[model samples]
Target: MTKNTTINYREKIEHSHVYDVAKITPLEFQPNLSARINNRVLLKREDMQPVFSFKLRGAYNKMASLPTDTLKRGVIAASAGNHAQGVAMSAQKLGCRAVIVMPTTTPLIKINAVKARGAEVILFGDSYSDAYVKALELEKSEQLTFVHPYDDPDVIAGQGTIALEILNAHPEPIEAIFCCVGGGGLLAGIAAYVKAVRPEIKIIGVEAKDAEAMTESLKQGKRVMLDQVGLFADGAAVKQVGEHTFALSQQYVDEMIVVDNDAICAAIKDVFEDTRSILEPAGALATAGLKEYAKRNNLSGKTLVGIASGANMNFDRLRFIAERAEVGEKREAVLAVTIPEKPGAFKTFCRLLGDRNITEFNYRYSDPKEAHIFVGVAIADPNESANLVADLIAQGLPALDLTDNEVAKLHLRHLVGGHAPQAENEVVFRFEFPEKPGALMKFLDTMGHDWNISLFHYRNHGADFGRVLVGMQVPPNEQTEFAEFLQNLGYPHWDETHNPAYKLFLG
Candidate 1:
């Protein structure tokens, strides 16, 4: 349980066959980051390792130390991405077969990486634990050794070499070392060595709040199972910490900092700005923790090292990451507004929008009279959002602020539509259809425009159903007639003209 005790184990880890297998690198000081933080901020660029992660060290170490008989038996491991690649690559290099199990939702890039390394890649389940179960099953069936990603002593010790490299590369008296923790292997390894070598050097562990298994486990004094994990940071989305690693963490780690998804996004941006490298959310955790620590303690001029653990971000995920970045940095806000739908209403609304740059705009009409429109606007700052809302209300515009609504953020943002005109005697009807080919055209053909189309907004959802918000200008007071036409059209229709939720949302 003591620091020295963990160090003794780390010493053995350093001498292990795994450590001997991988090349050692220097921990470079980041002057730009240091100047900004008013401290010497060094980065332990484990991301620069083969397979682009620190996971390779541990996986290689574990594979190298396996008994000759065990090597013949092969190895099996489960991971969302990084560990799978590491183990696969290491096992292949060591002349052993590897079977890798990953969530079906894992990016294709990661799956291909494992396969490229000569590992048998199996896609199963929706989460790491589910994948773990399948891997365990394969292990028994094939009689292969389980090469754990972070739970094993050899893995932790292999990761511990990072600390040795950092200390040797930088001769300064270190104030703190911030590391990202998932199942605690990285933290366990680094903290053990650093705390033993320099007892005064603080070791802080960082975890995403949504997946802080180690933090929750330490609090409960037992490993706690998480019902769900936020996969935005797939690399560190562990449900539980390893027993041995957790014990080491409890003994050597000085503090545990949990950051939210927003902060992690902001940190990703920060690291990219500082190092011009795109770090996965898990990789950014350590930098995020340092930001939090600096702000909380008002500490300046202290030397610190933040581990940029990995950079295996999927290309497709960059869009979502960019969208979330503004909100993460408090640079954008999402708003809902109900504006009069008559002529000049939108133009007036635009004028009222003023100089606040619109990041996004979506609106649809549901009443033939064009009495109201639901709109979402993006603002420049969080503080400006309230003022904008207040200003809109002052203009007699009914608006509901949904800047923080989860549903609005995830489902509604991209579903917004462009404005269209309606006829005086046309009837307005809203319809939801499956987002498939010919769906919209079929709906339009069915309507047949005996009543001219007033307003129409149809968007394709990647799902089975597509929701369309529409409006038709029925001849000045043909409510009953429009109802009959909608009934004849045979699509589910809702009269949202007077609903309060409708009023607030689409007034």
Candidate 2:
């Protein structure tokens, strides 16, 4: 029945009323990034859109194109992030009753934003896929029109308008256009217009390394579903590429690249440094791919365009971004070094570093024989971290690079050395300390050093609270006392004695 359902995506895009809620965002040249990569890197600022994302274009177009009868009955969509805002804003514009189903874990900011736009927010399961199933059920029971975030021709056409504006402003040829692919609607839409209008322009799709459903689908020549997707880039954390979007992308996209969270965080910093705007993890993914592509090909003096997709980041998440950005950009190297506990041991270690700026330093004077120091040093480039590690190892310092260790990055960074075998009845627990002065002192005083601190780690995240991992040694007979101690301590803690990473690294 629907051999021609795909229709002319390009024709629909050309006639789209995306400008109703969207705008022709600026295509700003990124001189700093361009100079660093030795390419004419430009950012298509879709982040400047009213809803702070290109999602509005598709959401508005889909709602606007609906028959008058359907519009009267209202629309429904499932999204935990940008798409929810898009539909809410679109619904407000069209004066329709919009229902947005979001995951239970969705941030309060997003939930409230949708509510502010007059959409009824229903918290469903823990992911977009779960919310999608619930939304489909509601569409039938409530008789609401399901407005898909990606997949649909109207949505794809709305997103495709980005390509039209990009080419219109810069009639000159672009070597490659990098885009982030979640459900594949944005990438598919842009690919349609670019492939049709400027067939020579390369359309490269980027995906989070941990969430590469679209990449896998493109490689296998069919749609592929991942059992699970990472939530770091929550906006692009789609488990499977849309069927229609995947089919269209296979024809239009030239290549695909997958980058890790570090690169995405680094790219976020890059955009912030250049445009003075911080983007969500998914928002900076396209630029991350662009930088990676330029480095891999060693291409210079070429024009590379990246869609800076959105800036709807929660302010608190910036702390995590800043922490990882250095490693992602290869600007900092984190290391765990065991130096002799003698008088000149620390001095000699500092001498070895020789003029390198110490970005961070956390040391615990535990053993009289040797001390362990968690250090982060400024680096010149991507390879410098490895080079520095090699230099330390060659110098007979038992050094281990903790740059890529998940446990080290999250917990161990502040944690003191592993389990103390000598201490009886050792217990390891993770805690969150209120981020105010004297909080640490309050704990120490409350615990009273009577228990003998076996391990402790804490780092400030520039927020209202700090995360800590602690290991305390207590005698078996003192178990009752320890329980009473914890209740009296009044600070929350989680036991991590059996964590695999702990056993591997510290046990």
> Which candidate comes out best when scored by TM-score?
2
What is the per-residue lDDT of model 2 for residues 1-507, given as tens digits with 9 covering 90 to 100? Answer: 232244887799999977878989999999899889999999999999998999999999999999999999999999987899999999999999999998775767788988998999998875577899999999999999999999888898899999999999999979999999999999989998998899999999999988999999988887888866666777888878887788888888999999998899999999998999988889999999999999999998999999989888888878888899998998888888888899988988999898899998987666788777888999998588888888888887878777876557778765545545566666777776654557788888887658877777765543334668877777788888788777777665667777654553465
Q: In model 2, which regions exceed 4 Å deviation?
A: 1-6, 422-505
Summarize candidate 1's per-residue lDDT along 1-507 as a digit string, tens digits. Answer: 433353476566558655444667557677775776688787888888788888998898888888899898899998867888888889878888888898775666777888998999888865577889999999998899998988888889888888888888876788899999988889999998887787899999999987899888888887888755555566887878888888888788888899877778777887777778898888889988987887678889998889999998766557666766676666776777766667888888889888767777766655665443434455655778788888889998866676555444554454444323323443334465533456667666766645655445554322223556565665656666666666666554544444333334322
Q: For model 1, what is the C-alpha lDDT against the true structure?
A: 0.74
Q: Whole-model Cα lDDT per candidate?
A: 0.74, 0.85
RMSD to true structure for each model, in Å: 9.2, 7.0
Q: Using alpha carbons, what is the TM-score of model 2? A: 0.85
Off by over 4 Å in 1: 1-7, 16-21, 25-40, 338-354, 366-401, 417-507
